[model samples]
Target: MEAKKVALVMVDISGYTHFIRAQKVSAIHAEEIVFELLEAVIDRAEYPLTLNKLEGDAVFLYAEIGDNNLARVTRDVAKQVQGFFEAFYDRARTLTEERAECGCDACSRVHDLRLKVLLHSGEAVFRQIRQFEELAGEDVIAIHRLLKNDIPAREYILMTDAFHNLAGNLAGMAYTPSQQTYPDLGTLQIHVFQPSN
Candidate 1:
């Protein structure tokens, strides 16, 4: 199949490593909490934007960009990104209240968990072999590589120049200029939108 232009996104649970590294008895509850948080984020995904796969503490998603739906899909995804954060925190808050009686490390530390989103626009070649589907390309690698960066924050929305151009105003959100450098990819110009909280 021919490669297609698409918007790639990843919603990651920050501070998950520390939260999940509890004792064996508490690990089960930690996993359950992570599962709940992940479910909340996944539930916010809408049409045009599909779940490509789950990467441990993160969800990888993509939306194809075509002439007919370019504007609509970009706008829809931009709004959907915002919705992910809202759903995540709302669910987290509810979980915190419900689990307050419990003294497990995972339950007590729910507030430490944060959400980070990464958006990149690029071309990808998608393939399916039986039930297993995979996306491969330089862009795909770049988006995944972005997960490990010097962002200096646990929660924020980071978008590549390509994605920022397509996503437009992003509901009139303000973003600051930032850059990430890798040995191979060099420097990537990114725009970061951080919550006021």
Candidate 2:
């Protein structure tokens, strides 16, 4: 098997666990809200990027680094990231407002949802089983490890140092340094970019 250069991304809904617990919403209604938002983000995905899997409240996506122009690839990934958030927040606002008069807890509190993205670029091995395509390698682990961090902002995008080196400048986005240690991955340095309202 050959290693392929790819950009890995994870879009996760923040405040989901806390929101469901605090609102005391029923499982059926809670799932409905979650699935709807997840679908909205999935629907906004563009070419070169494909949805790998849905891990509960997060959607994992991957795209091969086909373009030699590193800057273009980074910018495109940033654009897709921005598009997902736009769709997510817009749909959330609409749903919350639409159900404002409703008595259901899930419907009324839908506005509490937020989104965060974790991105990294590295070599990964693609594996296929049955009808599904999956990515496996250190890069996959690196992106998932990013999900747990001490970043104060609930809604922000975090990129690994490798990704930052290639796409950070092209993104025209500002980020702050974040460092965290994982048992297996050692001390990982990341860049945090908080999206503006």
Clashes by residue pair, model 1: none
TM-score of 2: 0.92
Candidate lDDT scores, in order, read 0.87, 0.84
Local accuracy of candidate 2 as per-residue lDDT tens digits, 1-197: 56788888999999899767866646667778889899999999987788899999999998888658666776688788978888998889888877778787788778778999988998899888879887889989989988988888889888888777777642555678878789998988788887864
- Superposed by TM-score, candidate 1 places the C-alpha of residue 6 at a distance from the truth, in angstroms, of 0.6
In model 2, which runs have C-alpha deviations exceeding 4 angstroms? 23-25, 169-174
Error of 2 at 131 (Å): 1.2
Q: List the RMSD of every prediction in angstroms.
A: 1.5, 1.8
Q: For candidate 1, lDDT tens digit of each residue in 1-197?
A: 56898989989999988887753668987888888999999998988889999889999999999967766777788889988989999999999999999988888888899999999988999898789678889889999999999889889889988788777766556778888898888888898988644
TM-score of each prediction: 0.94, 0.92
Q: For model 2, what is the alpha-carbon lDDT of residue 122?
A: 89
Off by over 4 Å in 1: none
Q: Which window of ten consecutive residues has the lowest lDDT sum in model 2?
A: 166-175
